[model samples]
Target: MATFAQDDDGVVVIIGSGAGGGTLANALAKQKIRSVVLEAGKRHSLEDIENDEWAMFKKISWLDKRQAAGGWHLTENNPTLPAWIVKGVGGSTVHWAGIALRFRDFEFRMQSINGDIAGANLLDWPVTLEEMAPWYEKAEKHMGVTGPSTGMAYHPWHNSFKVLATGAKRVGYKEILSGPMAINTEPYDERAACQQLGFCMQGCKMGAKWSTLYTDIPRAEASGYCEVRPQSMVLRIEHDAKGRANAVVYADASGTIQRQKARVVCVAGNSIESPRLLLNSASAMFPDGLANSSGQVGRNYMTHTTAGIFAVMPKPVNMHRGTTCAGVISDESYNDPSRGFVGGYRLEILALGLPFLSAFLDPTPKGWGKQFTSRMEKYNHMSGVWLCGEDLPLENNRITLHDSEKDQYGLPIPVVTKSDHPMDAAMRKHGVAATARCYEAAGATDIIELPPYPASHNMGTNRMSAKARDGVVNKWGQSHDIPNLFVSDGSQFTTSGGQNPTLTIVALALRQAEQIGRLLNERAI
Candidate 1:
């Protein structure tokens, strides 16, 4: 057995250091609380970021050559769906395109507007959008957002907002700047302003994007109260005979086993790995999983279904020269009762992708040689929008233990069980016409919608609610079954919002961190 480190007094163990964990670490540090963050991936530097898409697709993610065999795998039970989450210090935020859109007020009350689907367990959020607004504003200010506050873009702080507004208005639709993003356009919080490099998806080497490593984590570390341990993958939450989490078991880079004690454990390992960790921590008290009294540890998995629609314009748009989603057409965010679907979608204009990826969105004429070449030469000025719709939460869609597969640390791998409910498909169908309308309004020539891909925005496994029977965590994201254990990640969401869930996740983490800090100061934990 590897030697264990001396446990620090009043130490809070935080798993995963993405937006949630990083933000909470900083918040707790402000209250003079010490935290130890355990991250599965190593810290990547600016040197790791390259210009090539192929290198980015491989390097930015955790699909290193040696571990590629044991990397995340999709299943036939889940059908065509695939898992695309990154594992690292900043997690998938490193590769994200950085389009931050706040969910409309309607998203907090999905069940109230329309009854639940037959197979789905859709419900309203424990907290409303109003409760989250201040935190959203806090997150915006912390990240130094720059955008316009109008139609699609609702915040006027960013300089790019006006430029996009003009583009949207030329097509007859009132263009509004999107909500505050986590990018630095004018240099705030000691970070430099964005140069509009348009390589965010490949990783922002300039540190213009507000990733946790560059923002929250740095602040927390600077306070001298937080210790970030990278490349340490936790195997399980070690519980005492009384069923209370006392320490975490993990392996080092050399495959040496180690343990570290903690008074409180906060897990922020996203939707996929959070559930996997809990299920692996099963003991006599939690035979199924730790803090799984509701038997809902890994159920109700949801991801937004997205299809990219690219259009070829007549002018030299220079589409790939800026942010991925510079302009959006979200006239469809609110749920229209007449649409025949329970949910609605948002349409945001996307900058053109790389040539190989763009080919997937190309609508070339049948036949081959000459015809394909002719079409490609004509439509190179491609610009487009991504249509994202909500998928209802179904109990059958879950993340369970794989029969034989295990990770390097002898932990059972996550087996995802998923299928799009008919209502979900219908919602996507309902939004198609509206997507075409927006492109037509923008003078798109030869529009083509790409096939649906695995949504990176996954959430709602350990859902939060008012009662233990209806959810796993309470309104504060504290485990009802285990008072000292908390989950402050996307897995705690009761309803996956209509738009991008990153901003809300950040807001929720901040709110929960404050509450936890107060409770810890009073010795509640």
Candidate 2:
């Protein structure tokens, strides 16, 4: 039995105020819709974000003694996987590298091109790229995006990006400057431009890179409609006898359980947590899960399989001078029948590391002698190209409730069961070859390919489609079964595109918020 706070006025409850939730909160506020955003982590101030690596991690990330913190799904279940996620007010966006790229038009229509591959359930998006184009532009503008558009041919590529382009040209590979990241080149929306500190992942001190904490939540609060409850761990959404969701039950920091009622519910918790919440909310009305009429709430999980290839250049490239990823290789991103693989990969150029991470990621053994110090000294000149390839959405690669393990809050732990895709091995081989060619063109000396790992940009679980039988949500991110229930996160992705999914997630959330607002307004009328 939970104590209830009788709330009369209707409020849209958004769970997990990260990239998607925060963006939707801002959009909903703009439309005069009141909202309450429930975030598991504490709100971080600008002062909390400093320059030091360890200190920055302590503040912005789920590091330190509290390893199993449940603010956001930070770790992949397997130790072999390299899924380094963050948790805080801004969620993973707090420690993001901030390389925002929209998926190409073909990405949405993947299933139409190559119908059901073996061991994969590839599906086309309910919405088209053209429908999302305006929303993408809206998200870019709202987030104070930087970089030149393909339409505006005047602005040349940045210095760091130009070098990559030059190198790619030498190797007979065409590289395009990734248009419009959610980072500012010129100060927009009162945020400063990027200072080329090469520390975007460590939480930008200059507020150049857009995070939900600094941008959306504040604006949403100012609208007098959005209220954020920090350190609030939502256990489950409670429903009435009518089968309509009425309130959210959560435990606060002090272990005090409370309930807050809302007309509508939107579970924006990441790919893993969102599915866990849905599966946990099993009532007499919804035995399987709330809004899980299709029984696909925890299926079709997609995560990127990433590999790193380091290149040692003769001239010190000064890799630690700017952003982690300034440019990418996209020549082989499309589905080509000649390649013998359905999906392709992207080569995102990155600054290798400074010292600690470099030493850890490096394949060489660090002996505690003069040889160790000598090897550590060369960490500065090391730069690498991160090869990110799409893993097909397989039903077997799913996230479910661990029947045995439980969290600190006594909730069932998230259990992830993943297996490598058949197309991955061949795709990785091509990636290694392309990486070597790119490095050779850049006048690299010793080029080494690092061990493969999960890229951590995980998606799917609660997907959108034309019908409830096909997916959990509709085209507008509304639950196909439940009219008021909604979702805004990476979990709503139907197709995991070749590029990073954050920007597209933000765009879709913004688009969904508008649609949700209209639906609410129509219902009120």
Q: Candidate 2, residues 155-228: lDDT per residue as tens digits?
A: 23444445556667888887556444566676778888677777777678888888998989888888787888
TM-score for each of the candidates: 0.89, 0.90
The lDDT of each candidate is: 0.71, 0.73
Looking at candidate 2, what is the lDDT of residue 76? 26
Among all windows of 10 consecutive residues in model 2, the one with the lowest summed lDDT is 64-73
- Location of the lowest summed lDDT over 10 successive residues in candidate 1: 64-73
For lDDT, the strongest prediction is 2
Q: Tell me how far the alpha carbon of residue 28 in candidate 1 is from the true structure, in angstroms, after superposition.
A: 1.0
Q: How many residue pairs clash in each candidate?
A: 14, 1
- Give me the displacement of residue 364 in model 1, in angstroms: 16
